[model samples]
Target: MTQPNIVIPPAEQQTSVEAGDLLNSSTAGVIVERTAQVRNGFHAEGRKFARMMAEFVNVKQVGVASVFVYEETFGIKDKLHWLIHLSSLEAYEAMVHMGTSDQEYRGNVSSEQVSQDKGGGGWDKIFVDGSMQETVLMPQFWGMYGTKVDGEREKQTSVYQQQGPLTGLPGAREQVPLPVEQLVHSGNCGLLLHRTAQLEYDFRSEGRTFAREAAESINENLPGEATVFVYEEAFGAADRIHWLIHMKSLTTYYKVLALHVKDERIRDLYFQERIAPERGGGTWARMFVPGSMVDVALTPHHWGMYAT
Candidate 1:
């Protein structure tokens, strides 16, 4: 029996198969984000908390923790953010256990000693009560593409080999991962734009296809200037999808966004997506749930990589 010919979208043809699979193996897929609103008069204290996390707390954690501050976001002002990259869910579980068991970790972030001004647990003094929120995310597609994924293991191995023998010195026990720019020079990725939306129940696959194609088109047009990542909520709303765009700077983000209308490829894709199905157009808007979108902009804290 002969099969009939069927056309596939150009974006589908160009999409990387690896992008669709969850790379849950090692330090590449899972990201846990922590967010909190800074208290009205605690701006300097917020910075101190970030510095404390970067300098003391993050260094000892099982996963890498990089802190950020929200430059712009929906539903909150003066938000502090923490992005913890881990190997897997098992690692996350282990991290939680370690945080609970380690006395130093507890002392540094202890809610019990919130009133104290000088010692461990002063982190609570910086943020508003009941404003803390945490979300766990997995890269469903288009997640880890840069050297952060490619060279991380090799870099770690090389560092260990060079260490030879332990010598007592300042910050000797701590292992800090390389900054984003050093990992992938082309994708400096200093600023992050996080956009979240919910997909309609029936259009999950269609939404994924559209997002993959749109991301491909943007990357194709802009090249190394920007990159787009798609992540699905692992522990939150099942229908939600996250679109994370990484750019060298805010200026670079503006340039890439302008391409939606200015660039021929993106303009054509947009037009096709809006056209009717009877005219062989794309199906994009049909996949989205109304009024489920949120956008936030994050820049590195003064103590974090590529700090603003």
Candidate 2:
């Protein structure tokens, strides 16, 4: 059994060692290198994809969403600026209309001045004068004018003499003997004479004459009772007279009196007696009396009176 020891061949030994080395190299090198290459390729593709996406995002932020190829087809950039400025067509139209010239705008420029040179001078004056002249030529006008001028003048002269300065004084004449009976009767009659004389003198004064004359002319042919009375009495007296005359319509009478008198006290008295009662008390009965009768009864001493 010891005579033949088995000897391993060199070719077999080489084969066995080489096979083990091939196994180790496959495990450590080939698999790892393939995996690393796959991972690197994936990362490179991911980075390129992210960069492309970022380019599109930047274009959109700059108001150019599409690239050149898409922009040529869509015209997006051209319309973007317009869309931002004008929200709607109607708003744009309205702005345009407001900026345009209009007739009202033109009129505003022309209304600042009025001129006689603009057909408002000699022609207008001629027309007015002609109208006035025609009015004066009417029969009613002449009648009214004459009565106002002449009748008023006479009446006013009478008033001035009665209450004016001339009548306030006294004068004496040569004495003559009188009967006792005549003297007794004259006592009462003298007062009446004095009043009549004073009235006559007042009617002759300038202011009274003018007022009476004007009143007569204006009131001539005026269809109703025409009378003009003058007084220098206090407001209370004037109010009493107005109340009596304007009983039918205190407001109407008050207005007429106010126009003629020009005295504030008289106006107040009229308001107190006539206007207040009719307005506050609702007294229609007292307000319906004719002014003439009231005037006659309340102011019998007045300088003038006419029945109609």
Candidate 1 residue pairs in clash (backbone atoms < 3 Å): 27-87
Task: Put down candidate 2 lDDT per residue, 1-308, tens digits, no spaces.
Answer: 11112121111121112222221100110000000011221332222222233233222222211111000011211110000111122333433453355444334323322234543322122221222110000001111212233444334333234664432111000011222221211111101000101112212232233333333332331112222222221212221111101011112234344444775543343343322443444221233323323211111111111110
Clashes (N, CA, C under 3 Å) per candidate? 1, 31
Let me know the TM-score candidate 2 reaches against the reference structure.
0.14
Per-residue lDDT of candidate 1, residues 77-106 (tens digit): 577776655555666666778677988767
In candidate 2, how many Å is residue 248 off? 5.8
Pick by TM-score: which candidate is best? 1
Q: What's the TM-score of every candidate structure?
A: 0.67, 0.14
| Candidate 1 lDDT trough over 10 residues, lowest sum | 167-176
What TM-score does prediction 1 earn? 0.67
